[model samples]
Target: MSPVAGTVLAVLLSLVSAAGYALAAVAQARLAASAAPAGRGALRALLARGQWWWAVGLNAAGALAHVAALHYGPLTLVQPLGALTLVAALPLGAYCARRRVTRTEWRGALLTLGGLVGLVAMTGPAEPGEALSLREALIVAAATGLLIAALASGRVPRRRGDTGTRGLGHATASGIASGVGSALTQTLTAALALELPGREPVWWQTALLAVLISGFAVGGLLLSQAAYRGGLAAPLAVVNLSNPAAAAIIGVALLGETFRAGTWGWPIAAAASLVAARGVVLLTKGGAPAPEADPASSTVVVTGSRPVPPPRATELPAPLPAPLSTPLPLTVPLSVPEVEPARASIPG
Candidate 1:
C-alpha cells in the first residue's frame, strides 16, 4: 500500500487503541467499585473481563498499525496520534458511563492535544532503533531503581490530622507508577523492536517486553479507574503529560533523537505541557471540596444537633454524695415560649 494509506491506517489504529484504553479504564473503574474490598485485585478482575480482552487486543492491533506506519510514514506523524487517546477516551467514557465531562476537562484535553501536535509537528521523524549496550542498560537500571525507592519512601501517611491527604497521596503514587510504567514501556518498545517475533528471539528481551506491557496495561487501567474514583483531572493530567514527557526525555537523552525545529520549539512545547498540567490540577482541586478542619469536630456538630446532651467526657465525675446535695427547684411553664419578630414586613 502507499505510504499515505499506511499512515492513515496507523492513525486510525491509534485511535482504536485509545478507545480500547478508555474502555478498559471505565470497566476497571466499575469492577473496582463493585468488587468487595477494592484494591489491586479489582484491577486484576478488570483485566480478567472479556471487555478488557477487547481493550488489550485493540491496543496490540494499534501497535501493529503503528509499526506499519513507521515503515511507511514519518514517526513524527504517528507518535503524536497516540495522544489522541485522551480526546477519544473522555467522550467515550462520558457516553458509556453517563459521566459528565466538565468544561475544564475538555479544555485540558484540547490543550494537551494541541501541545502534543505542535511538538510532534515541530520535531523531525524518529529513526527506529534498539536498546542500549550493557553499560547504558546498567545506568538505566540504577536510575529506575532509585526512582522506585523514592516512590516507596514517598507515602502520604494518614495521620491524626487529616484523612483527605490520604486520597491525594494515593492518587499521586498511582500517577507516578502509571507514568513510570508508560516511560518504561516506551523504552522497552524501542529497545526490543516489539514486532520481531521469531522462534529464536532473545528471551530476555521478550520477557522484559511482556512485563512492561502487562505492567502498563494493568497499571494504566487501574490508575485511571482510581482517578475517576478520586477525581479525573489529576490522574489524567499525570498520565497524559508524564507519558509523553518521559518518552521525550528518554528519546532525546538515550536514543539521541534530535529536534530539528528552531530552538524555540522544544521550550514552547515544554511550556505548553506545564500549562496544561497546571490547568488539570487546578480543575481537579477546584472540584474537590476541602476537607473540614476537624473530622471529630464535624461529627460532634452533627450529633450535637439532636436534643441529646453531648457525651460525658471520659473523666471521673464528682462523687454521687456531692450530686445528691444539689437538689434544685424546677419551674413549670403553662405555655410554650413565643418568639418575637424583630420587624414586620408587608407581603409581596
Candidate 2:
C-alpha cells in the first residue's frame, strides 16, 4: 500500500476505534449508574448484565481496531488520533445518559484532547530497544499494583456528594493500569519478534508476560466501570488523557524513546499538562450537580418563593390534659339552721 493509503487506512481505523470506545464508555456508564455499588458482589452483578457484556464486546472491537491502526501507521500518527475517543465520548455519553453537555464540559473535553494530542505529537518515534527483563517487569508490575491500590482503596471516605471525586480517582487508576498493560504488550511483542540464533524464547517468561498483561487489562476494566458510576464526561476525559501520558512515560523510561523537541519540549509539555488539568477540573466541576434532595422528601418545603422549615417539635402546642372520665362530687356540705333563724325573728 502507498504511504498515503496506509495513513488514510490508519486514520479511518483509529476513528472507528474511537467511536467503539466511546459507545462502550456510554454503555458502561449507564450500567454502572444502575448497578449495585462497588463491592465483592459488584463484579458478579456487572457480569450478569447483558449491557455490560455488550460494552465489553465493544471495547474488544475497539482494541482490535487500535491494533490494526498501529499496523498501518506510525505510533506518532495513530496515538494522537486516539484522543478522539474523548471527543466522541462527550456527545455520545450525553446522548446515551440523557444528560446535557454544558459549555464548561465541552471546553474541558477540548482542552484535554488538545493537550493530550500536543503531548503525543511532541514525542519522537520510538527506536528498537531491549525487551523488559522478567525482574524489571516484576518491579514495574509491583509498583503499578501499589499505585492502583492507593488510588482505588478509597482510604478517605467520600461524602454522598463526592461521587465525582471518587470516579476521578478510579479513572486515574484505570488509565495507569491500561498504560502499563500496553507497555508490557509492546515488550512481549518485541521479545517474540527477536531473531537470535540458538536461543529459544523462554516459555516461563512469555507466560509471565501474558499473565501480567491480562491482570492489568482486567484491573483497568473494573476500575473504569467503577469510574463511570459518578458521571461520564469527566471520568472519560481523565482516562483518555492519563492512559497515553502514562504509556509515554513508560516508553521514555524503559523503551528508549525521547521527546521530538528535546530540552524545549519539557516546558511545552508541562504547559499542555496544566491546560489539560484545568480542563479536567472544569469537567469535574460540571459533573451532575450533586443530586438535589427531593423537595417532597425534604424537611423544608417551598411556599411560593420562600422555603419554610417544617414545624419543630418544640413549636407544637402542648395537648390539653386528657378530659376527665367523670364529674367529681362537691367536697363541702351546707349548714341547715339559717332558714329556722330567719323565721323566729319575724314572729318576735
Q: Go through the candidates in order and give each one's C-alpha lDDT.
A: 0.55, 0.82
Best by TM-score: 2
Q: For residues 1-348, could you state the per-residue lDDT of candidate 2 as single tens digits?
A: 999999999999999999999999989888877838565877787788899899999999999999999999998888888889888888887777577888888898889888888888877756655556666677899999999999888642356666655578899999999999987887788667763122545988778889999999999998998888778888888888888888888778876778888998888888889988988888877765767686555676566767665665765554334333323432223334666788889968
Candidate 1 per-residue lDDT over residues 68-185, each given as its tens digit:
6556656676667766766776666566657677676677677767765665565553354444443443465456545644543544444443322233433444545554554455
- For this target, which candidate reaches the highest lDDT against the unseen true structure? 2
Q: What's model 2's TM-score?
A: 0.83
Clashes in candidate 2: how many?
0
User: Could you estimate the TM-score for every candidate?
Assistant: 0.62, 0.83
* Clashes in predicted model 1: 0
For all candidates, what are the clash counts? 0, 0
